[model samples]
Target: MPIIVTPRHNSPEFKEKCVRLVLEEGRTVAEVAKEMQVGRNTLHGWVHQAKVMSEAVNRAVEAAVAEALRAEREESDARAAADRAEIVRLQAELATAREELAKLKGKG
Candidate 1:
């Protein structure tokens, strides 16, 4: 495949589009290359020099956020389980107390 030149290095639309492809598109590099109709090497160069660094940083941030969310959900689940266990324990204690009170009132 021949090399395809994108119009100018500073076109806003062009820069935004390339950034979108690398970051948010979720497509493979080759897929974006084909879709952009540019040579894969050229596009790779554009990405590497331009948006690739930011994209990689954004991915790290996203991963951190997801890990935190998962941990928070697990903690919430643990708290709910503890609450249920405490409720059961209190119910059992109440039942024992009621039985003792009945025996004291001459109820066998």
Candidate 2:
């Protein structure tokens, strides 16, 4: 009989599912490895790697959220400053109008 070999190229999604099966489903590494036709050590590595990657992703997401909040706060501050400046301009315009009206009434 001719020898046939199975390719060892497992996709990341497949590795994630296998890791989930072992971790989330509470299945033994050996059992999942046997069922999935993967080596026991390989599956264990996948599970450990998944945990490490999860922590890294969580940290990255937290940093991204913090940066976004900071940007939003800065934008809000800028808008508030602009609003205050506009209010001051409007108040000055109102005062000038009042002075002009007083002068006109005195002349009348």
Candidate 3:
């Protein structure tokens, strides 16, 4: 006669904590799985899932940062354009004032 063993079901929170212990706490999957009395392969799968989720979050953050940088650059460009226009207007006004001064001096 052959003997068989039944598998045990663990809670989702328990699985997440075990995965965190291996991925975030710097513990080996085998070590944590042993401590938790689970199979090494099972813990590895959870760790893999966690890594995939983390990668997705990282990509989203990078995209958001890139968008913010682009928006800031656009705002800076608009400000620079406005400054240039103001400079041109001031130069024109200064030239008109100089011309008026020259006329007054000629009359005197």
All candidates: TM-score: 0.54, 0.77, 0.81
Task: Give the clashing pairs for model 2.
Answer: none
Q: Each candidate's lDDT (Cα)?
A: 0.79, 0.87, 0.86
Q: How accurate is candidate 2 locally (lDDT)?
A: 0.87
Model 2: residue 44 alpha-carbon error in angstroms: 1.7
lDDT of 3 by residue, 16-53 (tens): 88888997899999789777877788789888988999
lDDT of 1: 0.79
Candidate 2 structure quality by residue, lDDT tens digits, 62-94: 999999999999999999999999999999999
Best TM-score goes to which candidate?
Answer: 3
Candidate 2's displacement at residue 108, Å, is: 1.6
Q: How much is 49 displaced in model 2, in angstroms?
A: 0.6
Model 1 lDDT per residue over 1-20, tens place: 66556575347677568657
User: Quick one: best lDDT, which candidate?
Assistant: 2
lDDT of 2 at 18: 87
Which wins on TM-score, candidate 1 or candidate 2? 2
Tell me the lDDT of candidate 3.
Answer: 0.86
